[model samples]
Target chain A: MRTLNPLYPTCPIRNIINRMSDKWSLLILSTLNQNNIMRYKELNAAIPDISQKMLSSTLKRLEEDKLINRKMYAEIPPRVEYSLTKTGKEFMPAVDMMVNWALEHFEEIVS
Target chain B: MRTLNPLYPTCPIRNIINRMSDKWSLLILSTLNQNNIMRYKELNAAIPDISQKMLSSTLKRLEEDKLINRKMYAEIPPRVEYSLTKTGKEFMPAVDMMVNWALEHFEEIVS
Candidate 1:
């Protein structure tokens, strides 16, 4: 009979994966991973399908989680940029592997 | 100017991670990974907090996604066992990394 690990009372992995598993979180993270930094409009353009509400809310959540850094530049137009933090950058290797896994087993998974 | 990868249209990674990111999926997967094979009751006991409904639904989803296999034996009481599929086994390294990242950044993440 296997037992649960006592160290994890609430399961932090669940919290972390739950954030990563959101429909737009990984997409935003992936986009930011490749771009290094992106403006709000640029991100909207990159992922044409995401709604303004979703993009903004997801960005806020990611920022709250500390996965992404948000920087605001006061200018004539008021600009903000999004980029992966060190922790977020570290998580990207796993994300890449996940994409590769999906590609490798695409047929098997679909069929 | 970074552009979206043309290879992914609807983003298959989203589907894969969505399945994995479920609150219970990784926990169940991590549990199954350690035990090799477990009976339904054993799994239930291992994850004591998960309601029966959630456990059943999550297991069904995992099976549908082809990440785990379910086997049944015909008998008076009947027997069922769950184990990770080949693809599931392959994904464990990434899961391990995520857990490690969570542990490494636990302090920063919570604060």
Candidate 2:
């Protein structure tokens, strides 16, 4: 049996949940999942409500966590694109489950 | 294809994710899953780091969302207890998946 000590900040479950539970991470991840790859501008366009600062910070955090990859081109204007890493791809099942559950129970939950 | 317009505040996925993704909800739910049932104080004690106000509000929100049941007994002083509702119980598979994934990828994620 796995004993969960949520009080422990270092606990994997705590860390992962805290990271993924942030306001924009899931929205960004799911958008990448749907689009396969997107430029920074495109991502900003996709989640229009996200402020530029929040999108940049969230993307940096996600990149640091290795859930998403950031690639930059050396062109005159420069270009950057984002996509999920293998681990990020592996993490989608859990996200999908949550999405499905939300769809099924949304009415009951909000009513 | 199910279109997810996360910008819409009423979107089910957005609403559900925002609620569950709150700092304490997942921890509280998982704690309840492990304990089966508990009182307000027991829950507060179980999650030692949580403030009384936070625990109280999170529990109330969970109750309001129908994810938890709050039962009251008419006794000398009155007794109240908490347990997962049927829908809450049904939601465990997704949580389990998250737990498993967190355990499996913890090192890779943080390293």
| Winner by TM-score | 2
Model 2, span A1-111: residue lDDT tens: 233455584665567767876659988999999999999999999988899999999999898778999999999799999999998888889888888887888778877
Per-residue lDDT over B1-111 for candidate 2, one digit per residue giving the tens place of the 0 to 100 score: 233444584665567766776658888888899999999889888878889998988989888888999999998688999999988887778888877887887777776
lDDT of 1 by residue, B1-111 (tens): 212236454366654566666668888999999999999999999988789999999999888878999999998699999999999899888788878877777666655
Show pairs that collide, candidate 2.
Answer: none
Model 1: DockQ vs. true structure: 0.37
TM-score of chain B of each: 0.88, 0.86
Candidate 1 lDDT over A30-55, as tens digits, reads 99999999999999999887899999
- Among residues 3 or more apart in sequence or in different chains, the pairs in candidate 1 whose N, CA or C atoms overlap within 3 Å are none
Task: Count clashes in each candidate, considering only residues at least 3 apart in sequence or on different chains.
Answer: 0, 0
